[model samples]
Target: MSRESGTATAEATPIHAQVSNLRPRDLLSKEDCLEMFRQVYLARYFDVRLIKEKKRGRLKGTLYSSHNQEAILVGALFGLKPTDWISPIHRDMPAFFLKDLRGDWNRPDRIGMSIEEVCAQVWGRVDSPGRARDNWSHIGSRSKKIIHSTSMLAGTIPVAAGLMYADRLNGGDAVCITFNGEGSTAQGIFHEAINYAAVHKLPVVTVVENNQWAYGTPFELGCATPDVADRAKGFGIPGLIADGQDVFDVYDKVMMAVEHARSGKGPSIVECKTFRAYGHGDHDDDRANKYRPQEEIIAGRARDPIGVCRQTLLDLGYISAAEATTYHAEGKNASEATNEDFPPEVVDYLNAGIEFALQSPLPAAEEGAMWVFKENN
Candidate 1:
């Protein structure tokens, strides 16, 4: 579905009354704040670029843009130690940048993919770890402990439980973070996984990004509960709802959950109340789409995640307005210049990646023959 980049005009910009007085320093250190801003900016730019590429017919497959939910992924992941594990769905692409990978699974906070790699991966380049084997969003690094996601609804929930169980067997204290949407909560697997995790006290955090709509269905129509977090009580585990638009609230709640799980507490559920700010994908025309109302879309844009974080950073005297503006520009310009010569490194990396992906041979015909499994014949 075709959709416009719901950027608010000066006169149309909604004043965010949701900004809280909680200081960033009180919750995050100086380094954490800086990294948070960098990832948020990068994710925003990456999202915008993906939209543009889809419009231009460059990116293939479904384009589920994480236009507004950057804070939830960033905040939840920032609190994770490198030794911890995370499993992300299609829209949680920004999370790939929060870690540092050094081929050492024992190391904490492994580095994530570079912007060029993410862009190339989305573009379906062979250089991507997926090797163009599937949709670009399915990328997972074994060394980094990122489990590749499937397109199935709530499919990974059970797999996340398995990871936690294995970790428990190995006597590791790391937690497993998995993401799902409000709609997925309706699926049977979601309930089964949560029930098992709760019974076992598995170290896993189930983050439900309640972006109000599950595909074309609104949360109200799909579920009777007031909030998705309430489902946690049924599982007998702690559940909390956080302002998905606010980074501090998300980070705070997720950190608390992580601590709880690390201390041998059962899994917890965190429902982030936010909006998708885009059609389900580029294939759905949001303007003509009857399922999602225009008024709700407009209202969602007013509480932009990046804008909220910028105002909070300024209010806390952590960063100047100029610095905030610069951060955005850096993210946007870097994304725009990936093909241009201005940023030689980015251009070079992207070009080489694109060339390798495009020129690389498709999987050989015989390669599939090797993966065959035979049951004692």
Candidate 2:
């Protein structure tokens, strides 16, 4: 992954010759690669299961499918430390559980939210980390270092910057990673937050999941530059472009940016070129199909993240061809894919979460107004 400077190009060009000498992915052992593959499957399974639940009318709220964008969440979070901070938006619900989930999926002490908690949030039960006070993807845990996000896109960037600033003041060296869609780049808060982080040299890595269409508007109509990372040039920061379909590429690019920030090099913008596999949310499915060309949709989802990761593992000799065909979850939507299409562990994991969510109780009626104001001593 090349470190980009000036206008962000469609292709990455190495800014320093030494960068090509070794990549973050090169150091990964076979076990690590296998874990990454499993994580991808886990993310896909989570999204698929939720879509199924929503359709069954068991789960309320709009379901934002992270269908093809699994790689961005798994890869970006795989290399992050438990102490690191992250802010995931509506499209990134899987990220809540994927963070700090590299080795142990059931570790009680992990910094990431448990699958049960995420499921509880979706079910609007009190078991959610936020106690079901907020709706979908709006919950966060300060202890876990996940920033709470609102509907306002790119609004969390400044929050991330402020969090890291306070951490630095307290002699902490934590880097904050905030996720956003391509359309959020046009928001005034996006520019304002990045400018503040840049001026202060704060360790904030802004990840732009450039899924071709931001809701109904296409990328071309929203931004002038071919690459959203080009906007980073104005702040004099490194903007990197990664193949969002390839998990390894995303990991490499994000790790590079992480290292830069950890070394006190300030902030970076990692533009991951991926496509939204489905409608922005389940509610827009019919409209999305009508507005987006069938050819464009087909082209965007051509390279499924799970398929890409599987091929990488095959090339590295980590998995045999037979193993690759054992579970063919890729290219199949939630309705088309079944539990048998995923690994037993992945299926069981989500099953347990859903079961727990179903059993969890809803918050008391009076709880809604409890957190509205903080009482003074």
Candidate 3:
């Protein structure tokens, strides 16, 4: 030991301190961490499996997975009930599954989904409530009276607002949640949704998953504003920010925002800062390499949301290491078993969804030929 001979060395900043402002709680419990870890793991596993299948040419088209960005997707859905409705974009599948539909349950068929579910795709089977077939989207809340499906970017924002409006009109006590990517904030539709929701004082919560990418372009390149939440002020709505990686933080912020909207205080915009682990799609052969730097991707992996939450859970004694191991294994086994359950109808449903668009009569050739805006005509 040094006796006044050597000066004390300074230690690097602690991670908890570095992110003090981002968190929404004093301390995270082990169970909180474990739950977040499990949620993120399920989401990541699904994405990874799909990507693997795509690489093997098993998948016919793009699989927009939220691999690294699990925190935002699952975190916000924490403490959510089945009755609450959610609107999402394609990339937000984990949230959709955990919130709306259960891909986990394994029935005898194990092929997953029934012809009845398939028949609802955009064409609306007689048994279907919507009556139009093509209902495969994410999120299903039975307790919160929620809806399940994703909208195009800011497209769902307005739809969510409408749901809240309907609730208010019908004197319903439920809430509406809509999620989108950071880039969607730049779209005019996002503003309109917020404006109308705020003006009407609807019970809607708009969440933006800021993972720094929209399609091939990096978020920084596409988003003009430094903080997307700041845009909420223009609509006279409050803006909340949270650590998406930490599921607890997401839960806290979302719950608070939902309460604010439900009480007739208008809507809120929550920007969850997160990182995207996988590419926008499974196939990278034709990716726009100009965007998404590999260095950035490597740097982001250091703070895995699932790992962080697991550590917190361990610290809180919510779950033991052995239990975690078993938990994870069980989740994987369940997933493997689930794939078998989804047979012809699962694929058929997807196929039928596309067919709904295709089967619709094409624009009449004669009409197209006759309806041109030519000066000669």
Candidate 4:
């Protein structure tokens, strides 16, 4: 519940400060450069659409969107093998770039279908996933080993551990990764998962997307430690702190973690300190300025992960500035198209949710009048 700095903006750490300082080739390659931009841009566009829809009452659910933290998820998955598994939180859905290799996040119809049908198949909920018990970002099938994300805060670590144990039993070389937030560090499950991972040498990498605030309180007031990465030492695992803002740093850190785990080393903790440019939930107040200086946000704006990445592409002559501008304009237009494609009414959605919940019937009601241990005919 605490942060690394006081009200004043925290000084840029060496890990993040030298993003522009790296040699051009060390940061990215022509082959994968544009792909990174596409993923980050798509994530931002998806978030903008979600926020606008929430405001318009077309989408009645809360959004823990990844407006600014796209680089961490995108970069980490850049080199993942098809056999690898990723378990992510709701906000980290930008990894859809990796999840749906053939799907287009910018298509309005597709995105709409995804959101409405993700949880329903019988009703074929318009935005639903068309599958049972595994909708909305359920990228992994039993054979694929990808686990569905739980909305519960800090709850996936042990689940990832169990998957790793499964891998060990089968003598598989695959790995499991879980992405959580800085706020989740306060949860007991976070510590328990890491402790077991370290003690048992599980092949799991815990990535912390640190945005400095736990909903309302700044990190300084939320936790006892300044750097959440420091907590890894207590579990006997290697702690790697990197700049979530720099796609290069994030990639390098992830690659190293992948290699370490593949080499039979224990699980490790990677804390990527980054920002959450949007609000906590769809209707939540940002209150970001109250916790930090306006100047920090403004300064932080200069090197937006998406902007910095595209600029790097231009500087390297991978794409002309005119092309970059066109690409961006195209992305924005696609976002608008997607946003308009799926519009719903608020009352209708509310009633639908209630009916869906009620139709299942309450299991407790059947046992309510029965004794604690009655088994007679």
Candidate 5:
């Protein structure tokens, strides 16, 4: 679908740009500021561990790590309330973890997911919440209202639309948000979903994680528009771009979009301009394909979300160098630890979860076929 650069139909109108230079205090409390850093570190460390597991052959099938794209997911999810629904992409486990933490405000007694549960899911053992029914990254929790993503790119955009549409029909204030890569934005589903959302005034927030490349293909070859958000004008909805590397920017823009939806104003698209540090998945090598330049990767790594956030905290005197190092080691094992920061006990707990999954039995084959409907018992 070639995106036309012009105004939307009569129903569409320009959504005002929120280019606020949000200060840390403006968006986060002292605890929030520190927790944000912890979440970034957790995402980075978890990804690194997954890569190691894949290399060691402990993890089967493909591995999609959101190594450098933590800020986008973390920031976006932070803006959403517990009642709001989310449809996550394959590389969006971090978002699920964050969502669980928020829990249902109405049911404040609900416990969020522990790090151990995430470890089990990544391992895809019998102990995983998916119960070996799905592969890694195709994660969902109905209790948490997260739509498990399918392997097809942009396949779930319409699903998010459906969820939001159903919510609107029920006179509910909930919004549904879906995550997609820049490459997926080129697909027909992306256009159809946005158009439907705009026409029906569905409270759906389509977050385009514009990580410069759609797998091996660069954004330039895949998308004609300079900014994916620019395509929003055609739909007559608000389109905003934010620095995906900067958590505050992502949080600020997404918060505004959430507000717009909750106020019954319709959909908004947010394009987070960021880079994917890994090569598509664990199997592909960007270096071998020469998909991205080594210099560019190095430069992007320099602006690592974890590092930038850590430094921000340090500069603001929110955390000392020693405390930051400790936070970095939270999810990593002792062998993986560096710079004298011993791995935290959570590492042992995660490993235990992995072992539990490994020791558990796979689901019965008959049980899988049983879920299908039958005319008669």
Candidate 6:
């Protein structure tokens, strides 16, 4: 199958078709492709490790596993410029560290949060950008260009649009990508924000991680269209779809949307079709298993994002057959997979973050009252 072939819907006209010869991924060197593959491993390792920690009572709050949805984070983030902003929701914890990670994982000047900071947020330590005042997935850095997300679904679209509008006024070309689940598309803010963005031609790319199931509700129950990308038409913007399991496909589609937004075309919706491998959160895991069909769960996780990306690399001759079989992390849950299943560097990188989080102090008790109200100077 060609790279462009597969679950990517044909509803939205292809933006890259005008270019004819060069798709975004086509511009990637062999090293860039390998880096994308490595990032997938990093994302998977982060989610599984966090699940293990929460299970062992070492972490707090809910664990929203991004098991099958790793491609969306890795692919969508890979093509972004360092200055571009992103708003990652509860299930997108890996995105905090994944943004601007392409060949600059350790660079202090990169416009993305550090692994240590993300780990601190997960651990609820004082070193968190929000100083542990907010819980997991609530931390954001203005310097890093990441928007802090709230519990309200699809709420950040307006914030992202407003941010980009201000950036344009200031003569900045920065684009903001807001990540949300398919369920959030049902919210009124989703329409209102996108409509506003369309009118202003703001550089906002709304990435709907349509993972089939939204909490206890299925996609069919909440959405009128089979593909969430269909919603983009109403706003007079492009709505492209990608095989959420394929990192390359996601990169191509999202990069198209990103380019469209950056060129002042306006906001676009790139719906990456995927499945929620686990429940809405760790606490709801058992209930999710019971509510969703056994066959559906099995089928949903069949195309592991790591495995898909690995196969693509193999097809491209980037890795030998022997190398492909070296580490088998895909298709295994946190309990089933071990550290050896991933690259040692990936494990070590996360270990450093965990160590930092462990040594960091908790927020002072008075912090709860400190940010609550403002005092007259």
lDDT of 5 at 212: 83
lDDT of 1 at 68: 83
Q: lDDT tens string, model 5, 122-211?
A: 766656667767777687776777777888878887888888888778878987788999999999989998999889888888888988
Backbone clash count, each prediction separately? 14, 1, 38, 20, 1, 0
Estimate, for each residue in 1-377, the C-alpha lDDT of model 3 and write its tens digit: 11121111221122334557433344545445555566666666556555544455543445666765676777676645445667767777545445632333223332222323322322323333223323434433333344555445687778778877876788777677788888888888888888998899887888888877677777768766666676776877777776767666676677667767666777888777776656666465245344666677666556666666666666767878875444332222222434332233333434443344334442334543452466673
Residue lDDT tens for model 4, 57-80? 554555676766777887777756
Give the candidates in order of lDDT, highest first. Answer: 2, 6, 5, 1, 4, 3
Off by over 4 Å in 5: 1-27, 102-117, 286-289, 321-349, 374-377
Q: What's the TM-score of every candidate structure?
A: 0.80, 0.95, 0.68, 0.71, 0.84, 0.96
Residues 8-57, model 2: lDDT tens digits: 43223232325566678888899999999999999999999998888898
Looking at model 6, residue 301 earns an lDDT score of: 92
116: Cα error in model 3, Å = 12
lDDT winner between candidates 3 and 6: 6
Error of 3 at 208 (Å): 0.4
Ranking by TM-score: 6, 2, 5, 1, 4, 3
Candidate 4 regions with alpha-carbon error over 4 angstroms: 1-29, 100-144, 286-293, 327-377
Highest TM-score scorer: 6
lDDT of 6 at 116: 94
